[model samples]
Target: MATTTSSYTRTGVLEVYAKQQWHKVLATLEEDHLSLCLDESYEVPPITNNGTLSDSEPSDIPESIANTKRVVRVVKQDNNGLGISIKGGKENKMPILISKIFKGMAADTTEQLYVGDAILSVNGEDLRDATHDEAVRALKRAGKVVDLE
Candidate 1:
């Protein structure tokens, strides 16, 4: 495989990683300069026999990074606060996700969070298989800093 030089900024790399789509990001920085070397032939493994991953293996569907992690902080005020409502997935087995965001709230103001983004984790705790009340409890325990990833 031939390696090629590509101009990639740190900010851009962070943005892509933050979206949690790219499986790997390799960067070379020298003399206050940086570059990215991409290996285009890398392949993700197929789904396992049990329909569940053994570890942190990437999903079988490569087009979309469904398991990507993103963090949104809902800042709190003395009275006014983070304005968002959540609901459990339609199927009991599915994870909880954002149902709605009220107008003029911290989440609405940021515009980074969305209605359908799945709540993967809260404050570094995994909520992937949590029940409706369990997920809500985690969020409520977060207090002023609501870290939704």
Candidate 2:
């Protein structure tokens, strides 16, 4: 594939998303009130039958990476909270990227969010152009019923 460079940002896209949907946020109980995490899970293998599949292996990249964007509703279980850690904020000239997903937590249980995933928004607040502190605030502020894009 070919590549091109330009001044492009995901913020604009997320803004449009916010307008299109209604989302509320949940607050996190962190010492710094920052450095909050989201939720995620491992990729499930496709079920196949005997002699019905090809011999070639799948792509190295996770199938989830192919989509430009998507939204998922992540409801945290009581007290467990959204199970995810993130990195790369606007100050870093990057999106809110998921760094880790705790097993058996809200994110992992949903099986939607994933490590290395770029979260454009949380509960409809755009993080595409937000700083690390701001991203943390938005994520922490999300309600029990969270929305991630």
Candidate 3:
């Protein structure tokens, strides 16, 4: 119900939100089948170095949720896809961030992946620095089943 904002640049987000350009942001998210929730409270992970999303350090996030890793396996077919939309990539100077998990789909069925969650890899390929197109290729090339983090 709440938005997750970890991999996006702080300054860029502020500019968009400041101007209330919600449509523009949404349009961007929908690009090339890539993938919000409206909640009042959220946390934005600070930029660490080299323009990459920072690892969750002990002081950066709550110990209870920090460094909590997850694996989401979704079955895909010609008739069905991952059912999860994403945003962010190296090209955007951000991590692969989950923006939406469609209901009654593979992703929603897992009950694990959620908006604001960052996708660190796909099928063991590290996406920490993958460009937006690279990330899209990784997902599309993953075949019928994909394991994501």
In candidate 3, which residue pairs get closer than 3 Å at backbone N, Cα or C atoms, i.e. clash?
Answer: 35-86
lDDT of 3 by residue, 1-149 (tens): 11234454212222123231121132113323333323325454353434555432212234465447878788774678788767778777667777667778877777666666678999999999998888888988888888997
Report the lDDT of model 2 for residue 147: 91
| Overall local distance difference test of candidate 2 | 0.61
Per-residue C-alpha lDDT of model 1 across residues 21-95, encoded as one tens digit per residue: 333444455558766645546443432323553232222433254455668787865666577667664256555
Backbone clashes in model 2 = 11
Q: What is the lDDT of residue 44 in candidate 3?
A: 41
Best by lDDT: 3
Q: Residue-wise lDDT of candidate 2 within 1-149, one digit each (tens)?
A: 01123344111001111443312222233433422122224222332223353222222335655445888898989877788877678787666777668879988787766665678988878887899899888888898999999
Q: Report the number of backbone clashes for model 3.
A: 1
Q: All models: lDDT? A: 0.60, 0.61, 0.61
Candidate 1 error regions (>4 Å): 1-67, 89-91
